[model samples]
Target: MGDEKKRKMLQRIEELMSYGEPTPTIEPSLLKYLDEAALRGILETLERRREKLIEDEKEWLAQFRKEES
Candidate 1:
């Protein structure tokens, strides 16, 4: 893909991330450009990061409650 196309794709990915909970469904045509492995890797990475964020937020909240007490 050309630089312009890559930039546009990255922008779209960022837009998807902004949706927060319940990730938006990617269009089939968009995935058609990516291989299965690449798509899977991207999803797995996103899931892992989301899980980590949830865990971190839980820990922070617990500590916050302790400090309040």
Candidate 2:
């Protein structure tokens, strides 16, 4: 994927992640138009984002427990 396309996809993914809920299925037309490379890039980026969110959540919970104690 080109840098600009990748950047746009990353921005969209981040926006979805900010919702803190599972992402809904993307529009069919959007998926239909994407080449395999773009799809793979999106999936890879999303997985990284998911991992970061999981780590952030764990840290937040640990801090909360410490404060409670």
Identify the leading candidate in terms of TM-score: 2
Ten contiguous residues with the weakest lDDT in model 2 = 23-32
User: On residues 5-38, what C-alpha lDDT tens digit does candidate 1 reach at each position?
Assistant: 5445544554446545555556545644775456
Model 1's alpha-carbon lDDT is 0.61
Query: Relative to the true structure, how large is the alpha-carbon lDDT of every model?
Result: 0.61, 0.65
Model 1: CA > 4 A from native:
1-16, 19-28, 66-69
- Candidate 2 matches the true fold with a TM-score of 0.57
Error of 1 at 68 (Å): 12
User: Evaluated with lDDT, which candidate comes out highest?
Assistant: 2
Cα lDDT tens digits for candidate 2, 4-63: 665566556555555665664454446446765876677688888788988999998887
TM-score on alpha carbons, each prediction: 0.54, 0.57
